[model samples]
Target: MTTHPDELAGRVLSTTQHPWRFALLVMLALELVLLVCLGAARLFLPNVPLIALDLPILLLNAIFAALLLTRLGWWRAAGFRALQRPRDLILLALPVALLIVPALVVGVDVPPFGKALALLVVTLLIAFQEEAIFRGVILHGLAPLGTLHAVLGSALLFGVIHANSLLVGRDPAFVAVQVIGSILGGVGSAALRLRFGSIWPLIALHTLNDFIQFSASQGLAVEQASPVLLIAKLGISSLMALYGFFLLRGTEMRMWPVSAQSAAAP
Candidate 1:
């Protein structure tokens, strides 16, 4: 009997000795790349906070993204196609609007024009790379586990991976906050990726949401652990994540089929 694609994926995952470990390592490796990029940025650029970090990040991430996209099969599975349902986009508008609340509540500092421009550029790049890796690659990879496992599992992975930031000099307190917020955002973003069945829209929304927060007035560097700001971040991110779970409440049982190569046993 011929197995359905989803079933085949489930079988592969089931038969694997350490699928979860492999997946975790992949995520860790991805973060390692980012850390390397940041290191390169520091070595070369020296200290323009915005450009120094942003430029190298953009370079490495953009290139890695290209490698993923170049493979026809990988790109298709990664939600590279046009939106499968336009209505989902409309439904997502509400969450997208609410996403900016953290920034508004915490306040924004609007860096000098040049720095703001660089920030915008970097955020856009990050949105692309992250959505591709997390929502696209990782989400689809976990598809065999059914909607709940796949979506939530990937979301947890997304959030946990940010801990790598601490190794690259981010403050421990700030990284803790970042990981919490990331997990929340990941939950929502993963759900949305499944809902829309396309990654582009989420990328756009992620870029906007990130741009708003990173440019906030007090900033993570100074806030350190502002109770008020942390509360606001939790509330906003949680709302979006809950809305995401709502959106995907009882959809496909398990159908995140990947490209031929992606699903292959190594």
Candidate 2:
């Protein structure tokens, strides 16, 4: 006999609430798998552009995350629905708008259509992998800690993941700044995930934001930016963080609602 989705979700909720050690281990294992995949790709595909190499690795990671969610009966918790509450969507838009400042200021040169398409695909895959791990798994596992702690904890993990940038030889200061930005973005996206009970919008927004930023980095001259532009970027990042906190204020965490049929299943 088949188990209902709600029944499976109930089991997931119950299981994740206790044995905190196991939950933490699961979280670490997920991140380690992702890191290992990335390392392998970098090691084996040294000649490929990082973006190109990352696409396949991220796709594999997303598949792994999906399988884990399925096994845990929390697959529906992904919240893929669109057309959520207007207020929540509006609040989410604040940071989405702010995220484009870097691309707008630096400005992108039109790349060959093929390269542009490749970048878009890469960014979309990145959104899938990140949202699946950070929001779907980590945030859900930490839900027992209450909304504030879960949000902060998951965001910290998100920031920590960016430490891989150091391996790429990015300046320590630059990677530090990126980590801060990731934490802020994590909070905002996590809020949206909770508020709307969906990760679809976050995926779309993340894809767009990353695509623009990546495109600028590849096709624009942001490396030699003026101090004024740097200051503006920092100011925009601060606003995004403030808006993230604004979104999180008064929010409460709860399990995603299962379907009526699933809920009634016995």
Q: Number of the top candidate by TM-score?
A: 2
User: Stretches of candidate 2 above 4 Å error?
Assistant: 1-11, 18-23, 34-52, 168-171, 219-234, 257-266
lDDT of 1 by residue, 1-266 (tens): 54355554454454233445645755766777776776766687677463235456556766776664443234766777899778767966777668665465556667888878877887888888888877876676667667887788778887887776665555577678778888887888888887787889988998887777677633323335556656666777788778878878777734434434455322
- Model 1 spans > 4 angstroms off: 1-22, 34-51, 69-72, 101-109, 217-225, 253-266
* lDDT of prediction 1: 0.68
Model 2: per-residue Cα lDDT over 134-175, one tens digit each: 887778777778888888788888888877666544456656
Residue 233 of model 2, lDDT score:
47
Q: Which residue window of length 10 is worst by lDDT in model 2?
A: 219-228
* lDDT score, candidate 1, position 173: 71
lDDT of 2 at 226: 45
**RMSD versus native structure for model 2:** 4.2
TM-score (all chains, Cα) for each model: 0.77, 0.78
